[model samples]
Target: MVSQPHIVFLTETWLSNKIPSSLIIGALPYTILRFDRSSRGGGVAIIIRDYLSYSTVTLPSSEHEITCIDLFHQSAYIRLCVVYRPPTYSLSKSESLITCLSDIHASSPHPIVIIGDFNSDSLCTHPTPIDRLFLDFQISVDLTHCHMFPTRGNRCIDWIIANDPSLIPTISIVPPFPSCDHSGLSFSLSSPQSPSLPSQIRDFTRVDYSAFFNYLLSVDWFSLFCDCPDIDSIYSAFSSAIHSAIDLFVPYRTPRPPSLSYPPHIRRLIKHRDALFSKVHLPSVRILFDQCSKKLLFEIDKWTRYSTRKKLSRVNDLYRHISSLTKPKLSIPELVSPQNLPVFDSISKSNLLASEFASHFTLDDGCLPSLSSSRVPPSLSLFTFFPHEVYKSLRKLSPTCSTGHDAIPQIIFSKCAYALITKEFQSALNCVFDWTQCNQLSLSASKCSHIRIGSKQASPWYSINSTVLPLENNVRDLGAQVRSDLKNSSSIKMRAQKATSKMFLLLKALPFNCPSILILTKPMFFHYLASPFWNPHYSSDIATLEKVQHTFTRQLFYRCFPSPDYPLSLPSYSDRIKTFGLRALTERSVIDRTSSFGINIELTTSTPRYHSFPVRISRWYSQLPDSIRTAPNIRMFKRRLENHPIIAHLAKLT
Candidate 1:
């Protein structure tokens, strides 16, 4: 108690039901959570400080001697478990305890720490059954038994295991407590640092791009390292020039000052109170100072509470209010089939239960009743023509044919669109204003852009609310690129560049192992659209996309297998794919398309066209086997697709 330890875990408490926890805790404000076996000399207890918000967790499946608690702070929690395995522990008891620990570790959002007095010496010459089990558990769950020193005498029975050892940086063995035989294990769990406001950054928004572009052009990029024979020398020289250009053009931004917490009136009152305190020697000043101090304290307290409540009401109160209204009434337990066997797999159980539940109900055929003499709902139709398109149409006209309306010849107007363009543009603006006003909203000028699509290079300036928009040749919408000429070149190029930058960033920042690398990159293969972009239409685009995966696999190979292959030619992409047992990006795209098509085969669209999703994927989707198409869930669909190899062989349509 004098040491003021935040928490204390004890094993072999030797206390029974008659000994209330309060008697042991005494007058200290601490929570004593105990899990006692029916017999004596086998119990676990955790004494946590009263201030921490925490709850005791019980494992129904685990009948062994173990206790767990979740110490929470805001959104994050740390799960601490205490274990006590007797020297006479059975093989069956060890398995159940280890299984319970594994479950807790897996379910926790943050890494957990487990400390115990297992009495199984880790430094024993011959490993016991419990020791073997612990070793296997450590390997399977990626946990570490960090304690190496002896706890009781020369044999180390006490252990401190954690799912992530890096979290607990400092580990030490301290002398045993009074009347205690086992030594104490002291360790600290490091919390991740809270995010801080950035003090400085390159201000790219105000960069002079024109000068930067000129600087880049002036550099002899093609003549990089002409005397050197290696590609590394050329790449290094090229990178240095580009980096210097960026540093010169991009300006650094100054940090903004922190805002004042108190309002103006409260701050003024505080200053007045402080000024009075300085003149406390005078009797009148003392009286005024005391009054002002009280009032200032009241106002400060009110403002602080208001500010805190306002910040929390936006999230915490709303979630709690909503959760109270929608409480779950039913819970499904394990189901047994007619054959008296329990349904263990999630997919099979879900399908069986859904079918059983639906057997008691009926659904409508989804057909509307026919009516006589019914009027169709009216829909407002609008037609639009680009100004450049109108100019092009006028250019194809003959000068001999005079314009019917406005009495103007086509040749004069075709020479320059100034006359026709201004009147038409004003009319379009009026329509836009009317539409936006009717909707009771104004479009953001920053969110809007003007672009001309198709092969024509004719682009006219467009404005919203008297603000001219910057013309863009290409724009990315919903993570898919759209270009002026509808070419895949810019779209694929941007995607490859992003993928390369993201891949290297992940590799450099994260401390993941070899297998974790593939897991991290698994989510990046999917292209946003199910359109032609899914299957790159051009040969160059396909090569560019495939190279991302190839380069990744090559990097992974170099990291895993060490050899004198630095200057040696690496294996081909196909051989590497076989070596790593991974499918190609194009192959993955087909699988994705096939599964999507299978799910939406019966879905009908009003404006179905040749380039529509279902129509485009029909070729690949139609060839899939019935088993894969009929799969009930994503997991089953993936499992079935893996068994079928012909889907990977289909040539992508250009």
Candidate 2:
């Protein structure tokens, strides 16, 4: 159902001149003809079967990327043209394209078909000048549009218009190619297309996660983490175990196509809009037509919003949604070498980077400050990681399934975390710094430091890799600042300054005055200020954290409100939050913690309660009713908990 088309007519390919067309087609029995847009937007291409005899036809203007070709089929010529008119395609350019198409139609003796995304918004009653011009040209040529179903978010923008109505007997909306939003148009022109082979993908849902976790737990991971004796063997054993688990558990199934057909009420609205579209020139009919069109478009938008909300409700779905919004990677063709030559090859580029880095370094003097060796200095160590700490970190891991250079997916680690949090796993993490055992990750000797907590003067010199470590009063690690005196006032002040700057920086960077854009982009804000679900934090710390959000809502109020004298007119923060159906960040965090605790309470029962977090978690869990605690998933738990007195005051924002 996905890839059955012979002459694939693709609109808005966005192919630029930089990429070679040959690279895209690969070693296929098809030839591609593309009109690439130089800067951005409005690119189109058509891939035809190489066995088919076809000749390219020229248009008068090169303002838009359009493909026109004449195909010789059974001793008769079929003039086929694929054109895309972007919503942003200027009226003049639209007119030019139509004029060119008109002239070509006037000259050609063979039956012609112009098919592509016109961005005409077939559902909208009041059409733009471009849509009208395209329609007028279609009417002039006596073309019949065979796009029966809506494509491109409630609008039948993509159409296959033919001069001879019988040329295309039928058309239906099909699932689009992977990564495409617009649905596919499958139509017949004398011959029916062969059904595409259904593709198979790993059915992750079928895999028994609980069983897999238990299997991994039963294995003696001490061999892999500590007893492997070498880095290479450790890596190999880890990889092998992951692969073996996959072979034994995960199953494969053919992917199912998503529903393309819209609701009947929407279909009715579209028909009504199309019917009134003919008499849009009449003022009285135009009003009713526009009302119908607005209602239809609003309905589609409403569902689209609901889908977005559903995505943001869960961790996995949120990750997928974020991935979808990621911008296209910028391509840099070459790197400059010392010789002022362009280095295109990967090896040369790596060499250039390595050489530059190696050359740019400060000379280190082979000297050490003399110190008293009589007294031994105390040193902090991470020889063992507590199970609770490991479990806490593991549960926070997003199952995006993204892998680093290790070739192991995060989902594997996350889903199997409950079982994988063994003493051996803890050893593996602790062994990250143990150079004698697993020398996989070498610490930079120059960047290494030692900070003595008790004494102002250094006790003794510590050296690694023949380099002496520098003693410092203050050091920052993983975005947290630590002082030898163990004071946090300076760190708090620094954080406040940084936060203030960032808040102002964001305000200056974006204009939230436009409520429409702000509403559309509100999900991003929710993601930024996420509900902390791990454990309940101190009230003081929570209040300090809430200041960030408090500042944001304040800024948002001023930016979104239109009043000149805003101070007196503005409502209190609590009222404002309630009006927006949003809860305090602390409230959200508490709810999230309770919900997470409810999901893992049974699994964590055997785990030793070494930390105060578990005690606090139990207290919070006790507050919840039996129904809320027994809920199947975190999503359900949170929903059920929202009705309790603890979280009932907080409204569901989405």
Candidate 1: where are CA atoms >4 Å away? Answer: 1-426, 430-449, 454-471, 516-521, 524-534, 567-569, 596-613, 625-640, 651-654
Candidate 1 lDDT over 134-208, as tens digits, reads 878888988787768777767878988887787678887754443466768877766333336688878999999
lDDT of each: 0.66, 0.63
TM-score of 1: 0.32
RMSD of 2: 20.8
Report lDDT (Cα) of residue 345, candidate 1: 84
List the pairs of residues colliding in candidate 1. Answer: none
List model 2 lDDT by residue over 1-654, tens digit each.
114356889888877654455445533445688898888766899887655666677787787668898776665678888988877768887778778888778777889888898888644688776678777777887887766667766678888888897888878665443345677887777753334557987888999998888878877888667867789989989888887887788998988864345567666766776677566558899688667767776776565555456446555554454433332222232355666344558898888888889876544455443454744221212222575543335545434334434332333444343343343333443343453323234466688787777544334555665576687878986665677865543454455455554455434423225433333334444443453321224444445556766776777777777588788888887877775566777577567655665333322232223223444556567656788878888898888776677564332211
TM-score per candidate:
0.32, 0.33
